[model samples]
Target: MNRQDDLVAEGEPEKEFNPGIAARLPRKTVAGGALIRDPAGRILFLEPTYKPTLDIPGGIAEYDESPYDACRREVQEEIGLDREIGALLVVDWVPVLGPWTDALAFIFDGGILDDDQLTLDPTEVRTAQFLTLTEATPRLRPSMTRRLALAQQALTTGHPSYADFGRDS
Candidate 1:
């Protein structure tokens, strides 16, 4: 028998690849964010015009775009900063809740900023500021708080962390 037909279960036919079949496979949403800190170690947070709570500088990845590239794109779009995105800090798997689908979120190191001016996108962001963890906790959603903590830990340890629903796993 030829190499293409070798040992095909002795009698079964080989199946050809199908794009339609592949398109129906399960998929997850991906998002990326940057963990930017000020020289005094305060984290940067953005008040989104569409959302009630504060968020980091990032957004959902576009179709066929990589998480790292998404981070870079979002940072520039959201904060008007083209700083280099550094190492991956944390990856959190968020479960389906309410109107939101399950998603994989990534946080990358954005290094420290001393006096970088940020020009916010008026349609997307209302304001951006640096706040201490203690001051930021109340402004952020619970899951975001946990994710931020894990990202900070990863930065301190020079390692990456995995989380489920923002809890370390």
Candidate 2:
């Protein structure tokens, strides 16, 4: 098993993370998301088959896969597009659901590729689209909602604010 598959035991019972709570919950897993933008500055998002909420095109890092690699891979799988990842935008702790592990979230600014040539992976992606912040803000997942809020605030006001991605946080 690679680092992404490694579980860091929490000295407590596993908690269901559907409706996430961060009140002193132990963090668990490392995951990343691609903040992909089209030439017109539209962000690409997907509606997961398992959870039909709008979200960035990325997922957990794979064995021997760098966080950057994972980000790119997730986008390619979910959005059916190639990407160029930029600097790290955010790094926060994530709480694992039903197990012990830490999810370190790495957000990156990603550049997009030829839209006509993309091919989504059926096993991972359900549906995808490019949306402006005005459109995407209301459709994101709960965690992504928080992150988007923070990111928007930071962009508009230059305040240093961010959200924790873990189920615990």
Candidate 3:
């Protein structure tokens, strides 16, 4: 498992009370975004402050914000740069969460306007660097790393995702 998986595995699942649907769906939620910036096909990832692993810059989404907006905010907060989040990437569910933990991720095509302006949030992010997907394959959350494999296959072929048609991890 690379760094991002460590964050979830570290048992620090941050929960927020969604007052919007608290009455209908009465479960605390944990939401976040994953920013994938492929400048020249090289991906950027963040090394978390409290953990020793790397992850795409993102964090828990606020109640009032859309997941897409949360993702962009996360990238800005973690990298201190502006980005354009592109297509919808992945929507996943945490099987073990006490609440309905569904994650919606958007994969944005981003360009570096100012590389020198990158900075990590002290409370959540730590370091930010760009690496090729080949370099990133070995340094991602298990689900993401596995997802990377599927993404590679999709790049070679035209299939979208094999997230459900694979060997169990």
Candidate 4:
């Protein structure tokens, strides 16, 4: 007898997979970001019109979209850059805070930007500029500052990093 039939014959109840149960499982929000750097090694930050703090060129992934694809799409949509996204540098599991849900945030390497003029989406990005990590630290939210630092470390070491709410875990 097949394994399933044998199990039943052995007086063991047959176990069945339930798609409906799986479908009803809780889901976390996902966001993707690009770690774009200038020739001087300064990281790029966007002053988003919708948010008070400066942020990287990225946004929430659309339904069913991979984080890598979301990063590329967000870079293009937010800053009008169609550059290739490189290795994933960081994956941060952020806990729920205030109005935000717990989320998985992915940061990908976006190679160097050598004098390519940026065309910021006026509706989304108010301005874009390159800043040294120290200069950026104060402008970014605490979690983002930590995430950016880890991403930079990953880029330098050629390895990925994981974090819990941007703290290395």
Q: What are the per-residue Cα lDDT tens digits for candidate 4 across 1-169?
A: 7656866778963464774676688898998899999999999999999989999998899998888889899999998989899999999999988988899999999999997989999999999999998998888889999999999999989999999989998
TM-score of 2: 0.64
Per-residue lDDT, model 4, residue 100, is 86
Better of 2 and 4 by lDDT: 4
- Cα lDDT of model 3 by residue, 1-169, tens digit: 9556876789964465675554586443444455354546556777788766677776667876666677788878887765776544444443443444544333333333434567667787766777866787666666666554544444445444423222222
User: What local lDDT does model 2 show for residue 147?
Assistant: 68
* Model 4 Cα shift for residue 64 (angstroms): 0.5
In the predicted model 3, the residue pairs found to clash are: 3-53, 3-54, 86-108
Error of 2 at 12 (Å): 33
Model 1 stretches with alpha carbons more than 4 Å out = 1-19
TM-score of 1: 0.88
Over the stretch 3-96, how does candidate 2's per-residue lDDT look in tens digits? 5345434345577675467666753456678766677767777777766677787888876677888888887777666767776666666565
Model 2 misplaced regions, further than 4 Å: 1-27, 96-102, 112-116, 149-162, 165-169
Better of 1 and 3 by TM-score: 1
Kindly give the number of clashing pairs for every candidate: 0, 11, 3, 0
lDDT of each: 0.91, 0.66, 0.58, 0.91
